[model samples]
Target: MQHIVTLLIAIVIFGMIIGIHEFGHFIVAKLHKIQVNQFAIGMGPRILHFQKGETEYSLRLFPIGGFCSMEGEDESSDNPNAFEKKAIWRRMTVVLAGAIMNIILGFLLIAVLLCTSQKVPSTVIAQFAQTTDATTGETITAAESERSGLQVGDKIIAIDGSHIFSTTDLIYKLQTTDAKSFSVTVKRDGEKITIDPVTFHNDNTEGLLDFAVQGKSKNPVTVLSYAAKDTVATAKLIWMSLIELVSGKYSLQDLSGPVGTVSVIEQAASTGENVLERVQSVLNLTIFITVNVGVFNLLPIPGLDGSRFVFLLIEAVRRKPIPKEREAMVHFIGMAALFLLMILVTVQDVSRFFQ
Candidate 1:
């Protein structure tokens, strides 16, 4: 019964995000006077559906993803307000609405988390990984209390001379960084100080401060910011992390697929001290997965939203859509490639499960 409930909750949460994304497209298309043929929350065979006023709203059986089918997305339609008939700007809005919705939802979630009193980790370094801020990077910890290294109570004052107040800002600083080491200033135990290191503290690149923030509160906290902060930061992290794949930062051993996620779910259920913890774990897992989905979709490969947007941009520039046949072929090839890639990832996932 517990497993069943967990699965149902997962489905609802995942489905809701996908539904919101598709709904964004559906609503905007309607606003622009475009005709939406179908608005679907999921893919494959329809589990339930109804149509009203030129739009068919359907709930499909699968919970993996969803779509909004609008007329003339590919070519011009005779209808005056159909997608193809609209100006390029309107079409771009309609096309980009799904991603925008995902970002909005992420922000909404963060806001909710903040309202609940979860302390979001700001740019402050709560604690370095077993090291002090004054002498953390390249200097060993495990010895003294008066050390100046990033410890469990340091608040990051600046990154490379830029002020950082929130997790979002810290993440943005991370993405644009090409510098070998970050010159970080911190507020440690209420005293202002500067810390320099041979590297920044993250994986793909070197960080000057090798530290983790320690939250005063015990619960998982989400920090909200203006300008789609969580989505952008999360996206940047994933892309940067992927780069590490070639540099031996990530190995097959670290990769996990669907089955692996389920394992975590089950483990949380068994290990959690209480129901709230279990549920929190599930929420955290869901957020992680969805953020990954948001980012992964942006990969500029065929059959992905990123690639589709790239194509749309080309169409906008040329003032002509690509031939449907060519687009379809590209998607077909992309599907095959992705399917093979999934198989490999799944294999990696399974191997890790047994190990």
Candidate 2:
């Protein structure tokens, strides 16, 4: 029964995220006066469909993907309202709108989490951990965090110039950065102060700043500011993760497809000490996956929105569009390769359960 519930939650989450993405394209295309032939909730054979004027809206068999099929989206068309006949700027807007919508949705969800989560941690330094002397292996009662002008009441505003809203924000920036020193900004006694070149004993395995912190009071400005920075941070994290994968820091096994993603959702939905924790777990997963979708779609890979946008960029640069047939062939081949990759990944996901 628990598994069934988890599955339903997974379906709802994915449906909302991807459906909003397709809707972005559909609405933008319609506003630009492009002829949208279909607006589909999924791919493959249509399970349920209906026509409203010229457009056929469909719920397809598969829930893994969807599309907004505008006239001349994949081919040349005689209709002036066809997508290909639109101005380059208009076409670019349509191509990029889906990812933009996903990103917007991610921020909105985070704001919801921030406003509602009672346990959301903050960057304000409630206290500092006693540092240890390296040679003596004894606690240094007076540490550099204070000696360098960091105080107990200081509210961390930024680290290395990136805005810091919560303790998670500070930790994320610190973990991802390689610098031995950072410029830290804090609010002390109602005044903003910058502590430049604050040195850290970075071991690369743990957080840089030595402090015990708590969540800020639910200040509207603070919450909204945190949400904005956290959104940008999440996007950056996704990009860095892809770079790590390409550089062999992460293996293929680290990747997840729909099956593995659902498994994660199951874990989040089930593994909480109480009802509130469980709810927070689900909300966190939703934010992560939606932001990830936005980032993934923005990658300049063939058969993806990013690649289509790139082709448009090329057209803009050359002041002439690429031949539609050749462009379509590129996307077709890319789609085939992507399908093969998905099959392999899905098999791997299933195999993990047995192992």
**Best candidate, TM-score-wise?**
2
What lDDT does the true structure give each of the candidates? 0.67, 0.83
Clash statistics: count for each candidate = 21, 1
lDDT of 1 by residue, 1-355 (tens): 8778657766777787788778878888888889999888887899999989898989998776788888876555688767777887787777777767776676666555444445554554454444335654564443222143455656776777866655656756665567666666878667888887525553222443345555444333334342245555655656666787767877866776555666666665566677666665565555556666666766778987778778789987887888877987897799799878767877877887688
Residue 285, model 2: Cα distance from true site in angstroms: 1.1
Provide the TM-score for each candidate, comma-separated: 0.73, 0.85
Name the lDDT of candidate 1.
0.67
Worst 10 residues of 2 by lDDT: 199-208
Candidate 2 wrong stretches, greater than 4 Å: 119-121, 130-150, 154-168, 173-210
Which sections of candidate 1 miss by over 4 Å?
Answer: 118-121, 125-146, 149-154, 157-183, 187-194, 198-232, 246-248, 251-253, 267-272, 347-355
Alpha carbon deviation, residue 26, candidate 1 (Å) = 1.7
lDDT tens digits, residue span 1-355, model 2: 9878988898899889889999999999999999999899877899999999999999987788898999998888999999999999999999999998998898888888887777456667776667578899996644446656688888888888877655556677777767877898989999999998776442222446666676767777867787887888788777778888999988988888889989999999876899877887898888888888888888888889999999999999999999988998998998898989888889999999778
- lDDT top scorer: 2
Q: Which ten residues in a row have the lowest lDDT in candidate 1?
A: 140-149
Model 2 has a clash total of 1
